[model samples]
Target: MDPNAQPDRLSDLPDVLLVLIMSFLSFKERAQTNFLSKRWESLYLETRDLSFKESDFLTASVYANPIRWLKARADFVGYVRRLVDRIRDQPIETFGISISYPKPYLELIESLMAFAVQKRVKSLVLDFSNLVWRTYNDVNIEKLVVKIPQSVYDLTSLESLEVCACKDFDPSKLSKLGKLRSVSFGWMELTDLPPLLETSRLESLTMKECLVHDLEKISSVHLREVAIYNCDFYFMCIFNLPRVDIFKYRGDIMSFGFDQMNTIISEVELDFGAAEKKNDVSYDSYGIEAGMICEFLNNLLDEGRRTATTLTVCPFLLKVIPRSEHPHFLRPMKTKHLVLKTKLHPKEFNGIRLLLLTCPYLETLTIDLLPPSPIATASSYAGIDPQTYWMQNMSYWCLWEALTTVIVKNFVGGATELNIVKCMLRSVGERLERVELHMPFDLDESRKTFALAKSEMLQRSSMNVKVVVHNS
Candidate 1:
């Protein structure tokens, strides 16, 4: 060997380290290591993590020619079966299969699952959701009703299971997987999902873009975290989770209620996105009935007053406050940290004013201005004016007494944001310490201009307050 040549440190590593490194690669990539050397030929077999995605085998040309596609699918199945057979008695930690059309390959998939069960796999991920995008023109949709194999529910050794786009996966068929601690379901009908929450030992659950029809209640004692994003609900749902610590929800406002009112929660985030406009089409925003929105928020805040110390919400929550009917409608909040995802509109200011009156102990405040939405109808802007509303001398006890830190996100050096910042500074009671302005990525301003903006804010403060500007 040349003296200048590098040593083969990678090959010198122990077999356990090499197998562990190969475990992170896909099955095909791991198998390709067989060509490297005789010692590497069988090293891939000892890897306990197996991931086989059908897209790795099929190509664009195969898709264009049906015969080639069929042959490729057959070859992929045969190769996987042979590999699984070779490692039948080995202990597997995780097994994942991502196939496009599971309808025609149900038996093979089931056999693969059986192998995982026998090997005591700790995590299993079955992603048949790709079938939705791949079969738009190739296969009939009505005949593609794929369900999870019944063997999955019986896998007591499974600690985590994630199923995506299996359309007919009935939650009622879920048996008690005693060791299962985490589960995620995507793109399916979860009308019966409440049963799993009640029956399982799951500590974490996530659902995305699924249809929830008449999900009445979730009563869970073991569940600790839950995230529901972009899922459509038919009616109001009730939550009875006593031990849940972290909860997050996004999408259209859905009416909901909680059974345990006094239980303290760790954190909660509710984000109802701003409306959008595409071409000439107008997507309606914040369309829930006023009474329903009011009731929903009241219930949530009532719980938040006792349970949550940190809360994050969208401008829509502020826009719908029942100010006229009851001045003290909102219960006094104990929330110390508050995050407001807003648009800085006049109505949003009115709502913020109402909210500030209730949070007498707020320590930190964040105002994140969402990207501008399409112009709504004139009627939507009928009542409030941003300039006069924020400039008023009303007392915000939280800003005066307890507020120490403030963060403004998506700052554009606009008049609305500046005035809001001025208003907050004027109301500073003593505890207010630092204010940070996080500029947008596409801000059309120079460093000197940003420094001048920060200087202007500092000039508006009544006491010694630090103003920091971050231009992204």
Candidate 2:
């Protein structure tokens, strides 16, 4: 047989690996691939991941009456239900659904989750943010969050779930997923999150824009890493997680049992810029959590005997408090990897250098422009003209370049930003070896500057270097 010959009867790939590959595909793509042969048609149904995206709907668009759109949505959903209902054996791992234009309102989802329950889905992500915003004139944004059908909670095998841009997802629904290891909830009307406190195995959690009444509920013994945005961590004593390492969040951490943590955590990551964008109208340019994380870091260093391996911080709207507020304050850090990322407002840049001075053993240092994100869109469109379009872009570079390794992402290659980045690579880092500049676009001048920076760095740096240029 020729090496490039097509195989017979789907003998080309192993079933488990086939399922794994299948897991990464969209539901429509999976369905289309199934049509390639009989073996594949039934293979996807047996695979662990299943997704239904309303964007994949094949029905004709309706321009005038809402009833026509509803009917088409119903028909499209019925097609999905019929196909899933016939699967010989249920897939037992991942199940997902995204409704881009939900009309005839989720009666289809009621049936879909029932199928998911039968499939025993282990990881589930459901997005209902699309409420026919396109084509229909009767779209009501508020209806999207009113109350997700209660059947969503029936997925008992779910281990990781991300529900975005849709609502009425009472956290109580999570209690049914006994084995959940990670849970992320966003844009829901979550006033309190006591419901999530019970998930002991949760390793990574991201909460956004919810009213968190009790922060103490999140002190899970097994939570190893956490990222929160726009949500309130009401303040609770954080204890030692022998295993927990990375932590990131924004908004308010109102209270703390800082005195209780009994062990050294290997890493701390704090990010708050997007939140400043999200709560623009109510933007406390200096968030309460900004100081809280700094204090948390200093407190942990005070108690920890072991040096941190990685420390990442973003002080977006908030800066160091006045010395009078904490007269005896000392920066807490002794890490090999130190990252300071932000769009620096002059006021916010005050105490950053002092904090870096404490990380004497630091080996890897990165000073990044504020990262890009899909979530930040809400703020720019929030109807409030941003008080300062260039609010935090100006930064002091001389202080940042002193660290060993420098990596910059989202470098727009603006003269000022590039100068700041290049100055870091050439100046302070005598041992700088790996310099990565990932640009989103290809400009010949940028590449030339990169090479020039590399040459300049080689003359001064005391280490062998590999300069990587990643252009996207």
User: What is the number of backbone collisions in each predicted candidate, taken in the order shown?
Assistant: 2, 1
* Model 1 misplaced stretches (Cα beyond 4 Å): 1-92, 98-115, 130-144, 191-195, 230-236, 273-288, 301-305, 322-328, 373-389, 398-400, 439-463, 468-472
Candidate whose lDDT is highest: 1
Steric clash pairs (candidate 2): 343-392
For 1-472, candidate 2 gives per-residue lDDT tens digits of: 7999866744677887787788788666877876777877767767766677766654445524579867766775776777777773654577777766444546766666666666677777777654443211233436664355555566556788877656445776666566888888765555445556554467777776554544454566677776766554445635444456766655543344443332556676666555444444432344344455556556656634545677776665235432213533555456778776655433444445455556666667665656442113223323322233333343443344435566765554444344444545545544556766655454478555764564455334434556666665
Locate the minimum summed-lDDT window of 10 residues in model 2.
373-382
Residue 89 Cα positional deviation in candidate 2, in Å, after optimal superposition: 3.1
Per-model TM-score, in order, reads 0.71, 0.68
lDDT of 1 by residue, 317-341 (tens): 6765634343325566777788888
